[model samples]
Target chain A: MQVQAASSSRSAQLPPNDPPGGTHRRAPEKLPRSRRRLAPYGFLLPFLIFFLAIFLVPIGYAIYISFFSTHVSGLGLGPSQTTTAFAGFSNYRQAITNPSFYQGVERVLGFGIVQVPVMLIFATILALVLDSTAARLQRFFRLAFFLPYAIPGVIAAILWSFLYLPGVSPVAGILHSLHFGTVNFLGSHSILWSIANIVTWEYTGFNMLIIYAGLQAIPQSLYEAARLDGASDFQIALRVKLPMIGSSIILTTVFSIIGTLQLFSEPEILRAVTTNISTSYTPNLLAYTAAFSENNTNLAAAIAVLLALGTFILSFGFLRLVQRRSMGVSL
Target chain B: MTLTTPKTPRPPTSEPKPVRYDAKGNRKQRWDRRSVLTTAVLFVVTVYFISPAYWLLISSSKGPSTLYNSAGFWFAKFQFGKNISGLFSYDGGIFSRWLLNTVLYAGVGAILATLLAAAAGYALAKYEFKGREAIFWTILSGVLVPGTALALPLYLLMSKVHLTNTYWSVLIPSIVSPFGVYLARIYATGSIPTEIIEAGRVDGASEFRIFRTISLRIMSPALVTIFLFQFVAIWNNFFLPLVMLSNQKLYPVTLGLYSWDNQYGQAPQLISYVVTGALVSVIPLVIAFLSLQRFWRSGLTAGSIRI
Candidate 1:
């Protein structure tokens, strides 16, 4: 099977060489032409159906509903008294003016700015260490680091919550024994970082694997040449390996940024233990509460639209910034 | 992010080449400052990452009374068996049902997704038709859109069709991975040959048959990688199920555990159950990832590298 595949693939590399079947075909090409035209559509049908229904239509609907509002007259206790109208961006106006929504956005931005770098840095370092010559038991270490990633985010949050609570937390117990005073992991100020720690622990290994793959793809001859140039391992890592894996780092950063904006499962699970995390602690959480708990789908739709727009702009802007910086370096 | 140059032929099956490192250097034995630092860092980070899993193991074995009083990292009593039994027996074995529900959703959803993506990606790679680039880019753009932004809207859409709170609500959305489609296209283009398809066509094989017998066999390695990714994704998914499923019977393990954790205050016994449940739910996927490391590494490379 492998031999046949390899030989056929070799023939494919040749340009339009000798017609298919090479004179073994006595039939007209009409049927083949028609079938070829329709085949791709058949293959694509299932994926496109779900894509349109779940992805595109929802996006369009969110944008559509964001312009409308549901109003109630008098006591407004009955569904009969409720009426929906085209309020013309009134939901957007309301969302913009709401401090809770803005605060959620602000909190997420702060979280991303601090968290993305720390996580990616640790990932890069771990990848470099594992890739280095001194590394031993690479498989075991790699598996150990990545094991946490296999745990679901909600589960990780729960496991870590036990470690965060004062009475059950071994880490807190250790800190108390060391006379560091009692530290509240779920405090209002510390909860975000607590969540950050969960995100970091869950993802650092996964990102390390990505970067390590990048490191693997690098030609070993480059390392040899750098070593011959009197560069130490540290120097080679900094000057050679680090610069070569820039794209990988940037790819992880983009993903981390996007992940930061959609923070939901961790905080939502942690909300059970801590009073610090409100329903509006993050933008996605804010949208969730607005739509479900508060029964304001229109406002939720507006927040979702804005959140999507913010994500697109931030990622696109980061890409542009990186592009411009690289182009400048070349110039 | 280097693309495969035209001159460098890919392996026949497109399985990622085994990891290779130079063995000529005898310098590994040297205990330099950098090596010490690197090893120490690895040790520290490993402990940091594994400490919680270790704690969960120890804590799950303790009864509720000893859970808080005993040292958090050490075992107090052997209640692991009891805790696990309680976890399963609670609410008419609802936790077991949630585990099975997770398997059904993730397994079925990922299988369907891999087939759909493989077919579509193969088509996109081999076919020359109108609006091809337009369709491909539009699908690729779906990768950029955050799922959180879409979850609410998708729920609203599902409710409109009376599909919300059903298995379809979660399974249907989980299967549409734009990123999977992207990876499948790249893999197909690099691995499959046009001449083979042409010859199959000349032999009067239907396109679908050709895909099932020929293309699918050749793409098996890539397919496994794609399926693993989608499986892990759907397995780890919490938000979608949380929003779509209101029925405890329908809850995936993640959401079920969250519900129990929420009720931890009233039913303090649930702490052991939740801890045990978390450990049970995590085992299968962790084993899957560790064993399938090679395939996923290639997947990560394929995703990161520009093709």
Candidate 2:
């Protein structure tokens, strides 16, 4: 408002420049201000367009789709005999009751139960090792650890999927050579572990990088002071480093949790390699199967919506809980 | 970053103080032993991480028929080229097409993502507008929403718009990265100064021109950082492509290899192909990492100082 009046009054009192200068600058200078305000919207327009058309619309569509179900009339071949309509809670009810979905959750939970801790522990140890004094070629080791993370999940899964095969696996080859025999790495009982290992191998370096960043942020003077107090290196680490880097730990942990829930690539690839992983191995895999194989897009949408809600409740609630425990510290 | 070392005071001290280190030769020897042990542990840790990748590199050169005959960790007769060529020739060179498709999906998509994120971030950082922070926060909130959770909805929308089965399905959603935006904003806030803009305005440079000539040059390093991150991310992405695509022709290397891997029982030769494919997939990523690693030093120092 102030800008508008100042420009207009200044233009009214304008001292026009020489004859060759055909234009006054004050009014036009203000013209750019109004446009500059609109500039942000212009900058945001692309993201907004894609966001609404893709993200916003789809979420709304998921909600609407979740409430609908197909009505297949008797003699269901005819176009008139089949239709989709509202079916409140039915799809959700089905998903919850389905033993396959339950099994997937249990399997993944079991996978997480075993895997996440091992990953965190390995990452923490690797981070600590990298941070340790007298550790030679720190950058070299950092690169070595982080190198695997650069491999795409699909590529990593493919690489590991082959190694799990009995006929082609070098593990099997070596075992046979040593007469130690071979174990089915991707068999039903072991497929969970196989997938877990793939995930760990692909992501441990990533988590280590984050954890090491947190480790490197620790103040050197604190460590020196702790040493002056006659504390052992181990004691200083346990008593000082861990507690100070707590927020970063929470950050990595939450990211890992989300990654675990979204587990797809490794298991999906392993599915082709092993008979053990059925179509409904994970909620995501289940949704994919329902949509593609079963031709139940509505059910797939329903599961997706429910899964999204589950993710929000779990991820946000867990993070919030951590935030509260940390007395308002955020990741 | 703080490392917990015992009280080894380094400051120039004028006052005489009782020092434990004068009589602590045993402790010094113990510390040396501890350092050796730590190096051994680090070596072991490095080996553990490299085992599988090393195993893949060694196996890729082996003939399919001899894969089971060869030991796990040793190289066989050099057949890397043969395996790669066999992979291409097997099934009408679909593997090569998949590799190309992956390059397209990750490369193009990541470039677009980096640009959009930088633009959005730069605007958010430099501009003072109505609801500026609201928009930034909205984008930041997306950081919590996992890509897998969003994949199905995005797939459904694309199919509804008849955009599915096209490159748009995989590429469109890859461009909106909350993390990239977050990083860009931080980088912009720290690196770009308000005085540069005021000076540009004083010189009669247009705002957009100022952004182009002055701001982008200053933000160049941040742009590269975001690009590298998004490149790695999209390259590694699997869930979105999986949910959005079904046509094998459209499959990225990850999906393509998976399909081939599934058929290992029918054709054991694909094992060699898959191994070679894995080795090929990692080369570009390693190169990108090494080239961009120097940029990460600034990022690390930024981490320590929180500036």
Candidate 3:
């Protein structure tokens, strides 16, 4: 089977050189030109159908709903009495002006700024270590590092929640034993950091794997060349390896930034244990609160649209900035 | 990422070739001080990474009261079996039901997604069609748009169609992975030679048949990579289901556990159940990750380097 597969693949690779088969010539002539041209579309049909239904349609609906609001008259108790009206940019304005939404945005920005770099640095370090010459048990360590990533985010949050709980946390127990006054990870001031910790723990290894893969792609000749120039391992890593994996680092950063904006599960799960996290703790959470808790679907739709736009801008903007910087450096 | 590169026809084979200094370099500087330092630092980081999971394992095996009273790290009374039984029997076996629901969502959804993505990616990779770039860009944009941002809109849209509480709500959305499509396209382009598809065509094989028999067989490793990605993604998904599903029966394990953890204040015993359930929920994924590490690692490399 393997031989047949391999030989067929080789034949497939040399199609232009091969003489046209008698049956194939007849088959194409029998099929309409348009139908032949449409074969790719036929292949793409399934993905496009789901993509339209699940992605494009919802985005369209969100944009449509973002422009309208239901105005309730009198007691506002009945769906019949509440009439939908065009609100133009009012919903967007409201979303922009809402203090909670801004707070959520600020919080996410803060989280991303600090957390992304820390996580990426850790990931870079781990990736470097794993890719190092002297690294022992590389497979075991790689798996161990990436094991948390295999665990679902919610489960990671739950597991870490137990670790963060005062009486339940082993770290906290050790801290208490050392006579450090009880530290509250779930406290309002620390909860964001706590959430950052969970996010970091869940994602660092996955990012490490990406960076490590990038490291793997680096030519050994480059390392030998650097070593020949009397560069230490650290110098080689900092100058050559780090610069080489710049795109991967940027990619991981962009992903981490986008992920930070979508921070819901950790905060949402943490909300159960602590009063620090409100329903509107993050933009996504705020949008959820508006849609479900407040029953303001229009406002929620506006928030979602705005958030999506923000995400697109931020992600693309970062990409563009990195591209320009790299170009500038190269030039 | 663009699907322009068609080089590197076999990625898995490229792995061992890159390690040019694996034996010679290692033996030259075996147990050097720098190597020892690097090893020490990595060991510390690995310990930090594993500690919480280690804590979860030990903590879950403790009795409810002992969880709070005992040293969080130590195995205080082996209640692993007891916890498992308690977790299974909890709330009329709701935990088991949640696990099944998760499997249904992640497993089936991933399989269907892999197939769809494979098809789409193969099309994008192999075909020269009008508006292909436009379609690719549109889907690429979908990759950047965070799913959390879409959850509200999807909820509203699903409710408009009266499918909000149904399995289709989660299942439908979970399968439309733009990244999967992106990866598939890259993999198809990199690994599967277009000449083969042309050869299959010249052999009077239908395009679908060519894909099924020739392209798919060659693309199996990449497809597994795509499947594992989509599987882990759908498995880890929390917000989409949390919004679409209020019905406990339809809740994925993540959402189900969150809801239970919310009520932990009222019934503290639920804490142990949550821990045990969290541990249980992670087992399948751990197994999957370990088993498919090669495919996933290659997939990651393919995604990064190709881009």
Candidate 4:
């Protein structure tokens, strides 16, 4: 209400800058009152348009289609006989019950539980080490650590697939040259972890940069104060630096969780090297298989919805947990 | 007009402290063990991180016959030129087409995404309007909604409009980056002062003109940062194109290489193409990252510091 009054009064009090000859620059205040009020909206319209088409509408459509399933009658020989009908909660039920979908979810949950912490730990360690006064060549190390992130995830998977291939693997060849026996990285038992290794390699450096940024943001005065207090460098990093960057740590953690749930490219590409990864090895892979290969769009939509909800819930739950533990730390 | 400022004021001590050495011209000796351990750990981890890429660099120079039988870490035969020709000439130069499509998608998509994001983010930062917070939060929620989750439904919607199996399917969705808006808003608030904007307003410049003429110039640094990020993102993006484009001509290099890698059973030689193509694809982005390290590092902190 106040804004409306302000805009109206501004319009009323506007100087009559419009020249009779129309040779001067006109003031924006001379524009219509409604356009003035809607100016911000005008700027936002392009982004909002695509945001609606891509984010909101798709989410709404996913929910809409999830509740519907296709039906076929009379042996389903003709397109006319097949129809999509509202399935109530049946698609959700199927998604929940299907061991394939849930198991894929389980696999990714396990992947996140193991991968996120280990990756973050590695990132935190690297960041702390680089931030340390003792570390030399900080810029060079940072670049090397971060270079893998520039490699696209699928490409990283392919690159690693070569290392995992028994024939071409230098790592395995070295292992074989040693007294230890040959190791099968693509074995069903280790394929998930092999994928995990790829994820860790691809993301650890990216996460390190975030944590490192947080480390950088810590005011140098804090370190000076800690030094004046006779705190050792290790103590300072552990006590001062770690506590200050709680929010960045949480930010990376949340993102990693989300990325973990969206694990499609690595395992999908790895399918080229090994048959161990099934079409439903991950929830996302499962959804793609359902939609494109199985021709079950409703099931795919339901699984996608479930995956999204799981991501939100897990990340939100983690945030809440950290916030409660930290008590006033915001992320 | 008197309020114009070219850059954000530099905060005190943002740079890391200069290394301190003792009278002997070595790192402080009191913590020699810690220093040695830090250096050793960093070196080892750097090696761990770099060895794969180093191997890739080495392998990209070798011939297909030498890939498996030879020392994986050491070069056997210098086949770099042959491999390049083979990579480009394979499947009637489809690899070049994929690279072009990738450039087209990522280049156009990132530019549009950055512009829209900057505009919306600027308005959010500079203006007061009803439901402003609501709109901002709605967009923020878009960040949490995973892209893979949206792929199926987005594909369905595109197909409904008979727009699937085309570049538009990938490009349209690629332009909606919620994270870009989030970054832009943070950047604008930090860098572009409102007084300069008001000065423009008093000069009778339209708001859009002020944005274009003054604000964009001020925000160019952030704009470049956003463009690089969104470009790398769209280039790295795999699943969207995987879901949207069936025609190989529309495939990004990532997807195109994946197709070749997937078909290794039928064509063993494609492995060489995939390896060489992988190396070729990453070179430009790797150089970009190394060159723009300062920009992205600052951008990351700017976007994440508040959180």
Candidate 5:
């Protein structure tokens, strides 16, 4: 009992650490007939090892690397003259103050301020619609809406990018024929929307499925009872359906926030097709350029660490908000 | 919180009060209105949703020279055969190689990752041992961390181990899925009962054997769910592969199309190949989604609501 208490407290302090001394755990009774308890730690061994190496260790390494910088002595004529030193917050300071980094944040903020809500609204509406129907075609819509999400992000971006390319695009051909005036969708003025449309298309369906699942889980008798009370369809959706699925809407919101904070693939891949996207089109993109293009590994690490921190803070805060607002859970 | 007592009848001695919030009648009017509006809206939205892809189908057919000059949103001609010929014959058929590489990357990577995740998930849900919660949280946290955050660190790790540019670099990291494990844990919890395992144990089955025979068979739905998740996750992955491999031979479809599009300003013909390639790329994705539609019903949020 004391060991269990200590382990729980220890988990609070060392979030990544297994409870110390491993003595607290008792196996569940054995499967198929034996009274002997099966050990969970043994079963969990595969995940722990993989998680430690890839997720935990790398996060530690990144934080460690973020504090240092390489200094070149004299005119920096030779490679041997350069030395790595602990630079405290200088790398972080540079990253925070950098023009490229700030611009990436602004651009993404602009994109997120528009994209996240639009996608969520579309998803929530579709889900609510699908929920009302036990109709024959509802399943088809349910599957069709989510089909886009199965397409890989890079492939979706690639597909959309292909459609955006002027000479090779059928849409462009159609616009030309209609005399609608072909403007560059991938151009600087419109690339953000181009990127947003790809994301909205890809994720809207997945979100709809999540929201629909939430809606469907509501007991069928509730709808029948609502009918008994002479409630309108809008009344049930607003009063019961929406409030019941409030938790899921919040989950999607948190996910969208995390995604927006770390936006990379769409903008990064789109960079090749358009001159509008810069080395700093998004925070991840900027961190990438700092690391690979500028060869400022420490600064790059600092930016990456910062970006991760931003994501953690945003998601944690969002989760807390969702919990408090929707279910009153103190996350 | 309905005061539902399916097996129990009203007690003769005393009657319990109905739950205050159980008057679901208040909700009926809204349900009726929502039903009519929702159906009509879905039909219109569904058409809007698929129009772009329809445009893609129509566009990839037109010949390269007239691609920009012709109407693209609607059909002019079917160049499906010619487009493939152009795609395959271009630059000694580099596009075909990229497509092959993609199949290897997404196909193998997703399958392996799914297995790893399923095994890990089963452990978390079914076993009760030391550090079980710790291990579960370690994985759960992974789901929230963006894949972008891992790209640079993973690149450094792969470089240090001399795995960069090899398939292993991309494939190894892919195996540790926080979300996949989360899904698996949820699935395992409901699907694999302790009683069955206890029964298996009474029959003298080993722990792994119990999992293999009883747990695995029961948890097949979750496995398919995890497979689709990993498959979609891996197939769409760009950053890690971009960071790890520079060799053209190692390029997946996404990266290959990206390289082709990057040079479209010079060689306009590359745009046609990229266009054709993009259209075909979505084919497998649509197929993956279609097959996995049923499993998508059980989501992470819904997992919490299962009871």
Candidate 6:
């Protein structure tokens, strides 16, 4: 996405008046030279402060804590008996070897494999349909589709959990009225997919809007040219529209991967209703359980760092693969 | 439009004139079978997206006994008012407190985040400085790091400073949105012309004054976009507040409802209150989204379209 932004900015050539040395010309003005030099940093000061405090500091602290663990002496009941000592990779080793952590990681991996593709495909289809000229009441349908995104994820989860419950769910109610066997949506086997459904419900419209915006940016002339060459609307959509918005699709997929890996809210909310979802059902959840529930902040820090590393690797690896494929196509 | 007209004149050897004209007319103004099918499909999709909320609306209106006895889709007894009153008065109006806390976090966090993003983005776009690209890339990388991944570390850090279980733990982190900065940069670059800034400089306007007086006016649309994005984001956020606040009083509506949901098994009567509370919680956001639809749409477009 940043690469795309960079290329786009380049294509949108900088105005000549806004040269690199443009600030130098302002020396003749009333503004002093030193203040002029410091002005950009001044504008950026608040964000930089917040960025360092909130983003960089936490990650750094996590890394710092990941290297240390508390050494408990006899009885270990007082502050003097406990001391923090460097454990090096022992915390990471423990986090890596934990069966529950692996289970959580595998669960998220499986969830992403199924959920991301399904969600992105649904979003792309919705976007293509909405971008079609034949689609009526575009504004109304767009808002309707997007309205779910306005609802908080926790609320969306709560609402869906109700709908999945046998007594409250219209779906369950209909099935029961039809004399069908009761299907527990929150059953152990179905809970992951139920969480997927909730996430899909929350995010599909948001992704659809991204792809639709990409489609809207495609010039009308491209469609005209395709039509002139005897392409049907379906064919035009498959060949032209899909390929043109490839980067946007990739962008959404990368985002979906990151989001899927951090699956916490939906499952956490659903955990209230059923025991099917364990505290360590997702990697983030496992980290949380470790830090707060188990009072093992070092292990939790290591798990959090590992999760962040995993996300970075997957996202960048996907981008690299896409870059190679697109490069091949251009060549 | 003119370009498409010429394509219709060519007669396809495979198809008859009527079918060709029908297809061409469908592409133009005429409503044909395809448009009908398209509308039908979209309508079904719309219903699929909206039915859960629809169910919530009607289900909340049913009384506790009728809620379990009657069908979930239809209204049993118009008990929405009673349910709402119950939801509010339950536990001494904790739900209202949660709502107020959510507004305080999301509203103030979003506003401050938007202002900071606008300033940083304007600097990156309109000004030339050393390490500008480096700063931009750092922030962009921050966007890729999921908030959930930072929850534990942030909790530890906040606890170290004795800031955990407080509003600042949530609001401070919420106010640093890298994505908002990215959006603002893209928006400012596209919307604010360099010549305007140059003209301001020539007229002896200070850099900060020019930004305040001129650039801000032109960047209003983008600023609104940033505000809405951050607002929705901060509101939807869960892991941060969940990790930070352990006190029931500090809970946002999301966390508060989750806690109530946890207790619903022991007190089945609280189910109606949860339903009503969910309904009430979403109403403000739905209203905001509907009213500010245009700004958000434009924001989405500007944020997505790389060029």
Q: CAPRI verdict on model 3?
A: medium
lDDT of 2 by residue, A71-126 (tens): 67777455556688889889888888989888877777777778988998888878
Predictions ranked by TM-score, top down? Answer: 4, 3, 1, 6, 2, 5
- Choose 1 or 6, whichever is better by DockQ: 1
Candidate 3: stretches off by over 4 Å: A1-29, A74-80, A327-331, B1-19, B23-29
The most accurate candidate by TM-score is: 4
lDDT of 4: 0.84
Q: What does candidate 6's lDDT look like per residue over B170-288, in tens digits?
A: 99998888888887887788878777876665554677998899987877877887888888888888888888998988899988888888887787768888888888999889988
Residue A305 in candidate 6, Cα distance off native in Å: 0.5
The global C-alpha lDDT for each of the candidates, from Candidate 1 onward, is 0.83, 0.72, 0.82, 0.84, 0.73, 0.81
Q: Write the per-residue lDDT of candidate 5 for residues A213-297, one digit (tens) a residue.
A: 6775677677778877998767888887987777677767877887888888888777776789888889898888888898777
Query: Deviation in angstroms for B28 in model 5?
Result: 16
lDDT of 5 by residue, B69-123 (tens): 6765656666778888888888888888888888887788778777778888887
Instruction: Estimate the TM-score of every prediction.
Output: 0.91, 0.86, 0.91, 0.93, 0.84, 0.89
Q: What TM-score does the first chain of candidate 3 have?
A: 0.89
Evaluate model 2: give its lDDT: 0.72
Query: Which lDDT tens digits does candidate 3 get at residues B1-307?
Result: 3222323455532433324556345453367787788778788888888999888888889888898889888988788898899899988999989989999999999999999999999888877778888999899899888898788888877887899899999998988889989888878878787677656765767778888999888777778888998898898789889889989999998899889888877887788888888888887778878666766667777776544
Better of 1 and 6 by TM-score: 1
Tens-digit per-residue lDDT, A1-331, candidate 1: 3333533553464334344545453443444556767888999999999899889999999999888888776685565466899999889889889899889999999999999999999999999988887676677788899989888888999998888987878899899999999999999999999999999999999899889888877887898888789998789889999987876777788778888999998899888888999999998999999999998999999999998899889987887778786652210
* Model 5 segments more than 4 A misplaced: A1-38, A72-81, A133-136, A162-189, A328-331, B1-40, B299-307
Q: Write the per-residue lDDT of candidate 4 for residues A1-331, one digit (tens) a residue.
A: 4445555655565557653334475655546467657888999999999899899899999999999999767775565476888899999999889898888988998999999999999999999988887876677888899999888888999999999998889999999999579899999989999999999999899899888877877767787778889999899989999998787888898889889999999899888778999999999999999998988999999999999998889888888898899864764
Per DockQ, the best of the predicted structures is 4
Model 1 alpha-carbon drift over 4 Å, by segment: A1-30, A74-79, A327-331, B1-20, B28-37
